[model samples]
Target: MYQYSEFDKQFVRNRAAQYRDQLERNLAGTLSDDEFRPLRLQNGWYLQRYAPMARISVPYGELSSEQLRVLGTIARDYDKPDAALLAEAQEKQTALGTVPVPGTNRQVGSELKYGYGHFTTRTNVQFNWIPLVKSAEVMELLASVNMHGIQTSGNAIRNITADHLAGIAVDEVADPRPFVEIIRQWAALHPEFVFLPRKFKIAVNGAQEDRAALGWYDIGLQLLRNEAGELGFRVQVGGGMGRTPIIGTVVGQFVPWQQILNYIEACVRVYNQYGRRDNIWKARIKILVKSEGQAYIDKVEEEFRQIVELDGAPHTITQAEYDRIAAQFAPPVLQRQPRDAAAQQVHQIIRADAEADPGYDRWLQRNVLPHRNPELRAVVLSFKRLGQHPGDCTADQFDAAAQLAERFSAGEARVTHEQNLLLPWVHQDDLPELWAAARKLGLARPNIGLITDMIACPGGDFCSLANARSLPIAEAITERFQDLDEEWDIGEIDINFSGCINSCGHHHAGHIGILGVDKDGKEWYQITLGGGDGSRAGGPASPGKIVGPSFAKEEVAGVIEALIDTYRQLRQPAANGRLETFIATLRRVGHEPFKAAANAARFVEKEVA
Candidate 1:
């Protein structure tokens, strides 16, 4: 984890002080709501559906145990009573006469109420309920952990996300964390681009598997090796999801590693200067790039030349600075477990137990990933508990995860783009103990990359921008697909939901994306098929194609089931009992089969699926 330098600490403290004064004025009526809106948004505070929400930045999704514990404290001490909203939603469900089983988590009023924050797909934490007056206190608490909401909102560069497996992945070409951090630092409070055409997002992926959903972001960088074995970024720009979805175009095939910052700066500068400003909906760089086509590239290259001529501008990151940031993220040294005859005898016992214990065996298969180090394995803690919203963890679970981080892995963890937690440096020998601890904390669902591990936003439940509730739909899907075998049989599915076109849930990136819309005051859902974050077999990531007509909210779960059934019935036979994933089948056979299935699965009755 990156340690805060004294200068960094001072800078954050000063910023907090400024925000505190700003909050006091807003509360005192010295500043009007209009004036306070932008100020609050700049600090990641939002006037949500029924309360103020604060988005805390988890830059590159890396944090230490101490930081997480503090977040847990914030949740327990400062969060509003979320039961008010849940109760309201329940009343609506009753009005419809659909008495679905209540969620298992009934501790709505518990002291350590579950969850440090709502983990978002962009790898940030959002407190859905917080008092407006205590906004300053929230900022102070965040600062205590050397974290802040700086640039998390307000049309600035959003938190830079990287592959959660950056340093630990078995197939990584380079650790993109350092570069991501460098970009964050440069883009933070940047005077020139503070108020761009609209909010911009960037991502970096180091592995062959594009876990970061690089394509849907405004700027996407995939670090790869050249023929000469030099590490560099394959740059993709202009890809976005909303009313109009397009896969990013290749801006630079392989921008040298050292010159990545320069390349990105050039792109940002070009967009800032020439991107649309007339229509808010069409203000993104994606639109500008689409309209201008090759001219966008020509301008960016021209900007790059000008910036290089000016010695890379003030935004240029030097080799020394890069090394300094990289040092902060250096891989941990591990004491490899001895693998002698005695170890083999011990391994026999473990193997035999794994064969006998189906639950533990399934967890090992689903939640574990190959590690770069031979003796260590990266663990994905399943935050996808069925009764709960996907990617949500209670405050108690956050505390436990913090303790687990210290005890089993290093004193650190990473947040995934899928809204899950990653113990990126766990030793293979400690898997049993870690799994047991996670099970107790509701983090051991054995559903990573399965259909049940859906990515959903707070939706109409918390976000004022949403037209429908996303959490309920997510909960419904999880409840319907409780069977582990069935989920596995479906195999490698991405079911993401967004309450609106903001794409906070990365709906367009999912193999099966559900977007909620307002149809005559009723919540309707539009489904998209065949879209995926990255390409199959190391190809380019493509946006999903819309599948036929939209369906009513009552039909969401059945429609999802229908899609799964379609894949099951129409997909090619499993090779070695491993079924071809939905995305792979779509790439091979196209979306017509799934479209037919979804149409057949429509809900004609008023009953909710």
Candidate 2:
């Protein structure tokens, strides 16, 4: 993990103090709401549906145990709405009524939860109930740990994301964290690019697997070595999901690693100069690239040439600077011996446990990942479980995760793109003990890539931009798939649920996508199939195809069930003699069978006015 220098620490402190002054002025009526709104947004404060939401940047998904503890403190001490405000919000929620769970007499509860942090797909932490009045205090607390929410919101470059297994992945040709950190520093508050046509996101993947879902980012950089054995990047641009979902096109086959920043500068400059500003819907770079096609790439290439030939490539990364940053990411020293007597005994015990206990075996199969160091494993802490919104961790859970990280992972953790926490440096000998501890904390659920491990956003329950509530649908689907045997049988699947077209939940990347829609002021849902996040689970990066017209709210769970059943019935055995994945089957047979099943699953109901 990168440690903050004295200058870095002071910079954050100063920013916090500046925010306090701005917040106080806004409260004192010297600064109007219109004048203060952009300032607050720059500091990651948003006036959400019922309260203020704070998005804290976790650069490249890295966090130290100390920083995690402070996040826990923020959750416990500051993520609270005033009592009167909470009462008012609850009253409004009651007036909205509830969506009944299909085939049951029960209705989804309209409960408002606070005192927790939500880990987003972009590897940022969000608090939904933080009072705007106390936001300055919260910013100061974050600054103490060298953390902040700078550029996490607004039409600026957001936090840079990389594969959670960046440095430790076995197949990585080069570590992406150093570049990710460099980009984070460079783009944090660049004056010229502070307000682009729309918000931009960048993701990097160093390993062979596309763990960071690079194709869905505004800019996707994949580190690789060419035939000449020189390290470089394959650059992809214009990927995003909103009303328009697109897979980024590869514009640069291999740009030398030294000129990545320069190339990126050219790319963004073109978008900034030509991207639409009049229409909010078409402001994103994706829209520009889609509409312009090869012309966009030609412009970017011309800009790159101008930057390199005429401007002396000012942003080129020098070898010395790269080494300085890379040094911070050197593998942490381990305390355990791989072949010691105690290690052997633990290994034997693990083997015995796997032979005897299916739960332990399944946990190993799903959660434990291979590390570059043979003596260690990267372990995922599952957040997708029953009775809670996906990616949400209470104050106590945050503290417990910190403790676990300290005990097993060298005081470090990474927030995965799939909305889970990963202890990336756990010793192989400690798996049994770590599993037992994490299980006690309710963080160890062996459903990493299964049907139950769905991704969901905080929908209409919190986001003012939402068209419908995503939590109730997520909860209903989670309840429908609680049986461990059944979930494992369903195998690897990604169910991404978003409350609206903003695609915060990454519904366009899931094998099965559920998007909340509004029909004549009533809640409805649109289902899509065969979407992949450029991973083996769904194969390549592509947006899902909608099955048909939107269905009523109560029909979603049944439709999902019907789609899964359709897959189970039609799937054929693969070369490995295992049942083909839902995506593979759907792709082979096309969407008609699944669409038919989904429509048949709908129940007769009175139309809503």
Highest-scoring model, lDDT: 2
Please report, in order, the local distance difference test score of every candidate based on alpha carbons.
0.80, 0.88
- Could you tell me every candidate's TM-score relative to the true structure? 0.91, 0.95
For candidate 2, give the lDDT of residue 243. Answer: 94
lDDT of 2 by residue, 1-609 (tens): 897779889999999999999999999999999999999999899988777899999999999999999999999899887887677666766776543211111134534445789999998999988888889999999999999999799999999999999999998988999999888888989897999999999998899988889999999999999998999999999999999999998989999999999999999999999999999999999998989999999999999999999999999999999998888787777676456898788767766765587788899999999999998999999988887778888899889999999989999999988889999999887888888788888888899999888899988878888888788788778988999999988888889999999999999988999898888888889999889998767589999999899988778888889988998999899889998888889889998999999999888433321
Clashes of 1: 5
Candidate 1 has which clashing residue pairs, if any?
Answer: 114-394, 114-395, 115-394, 115-395, 531-544
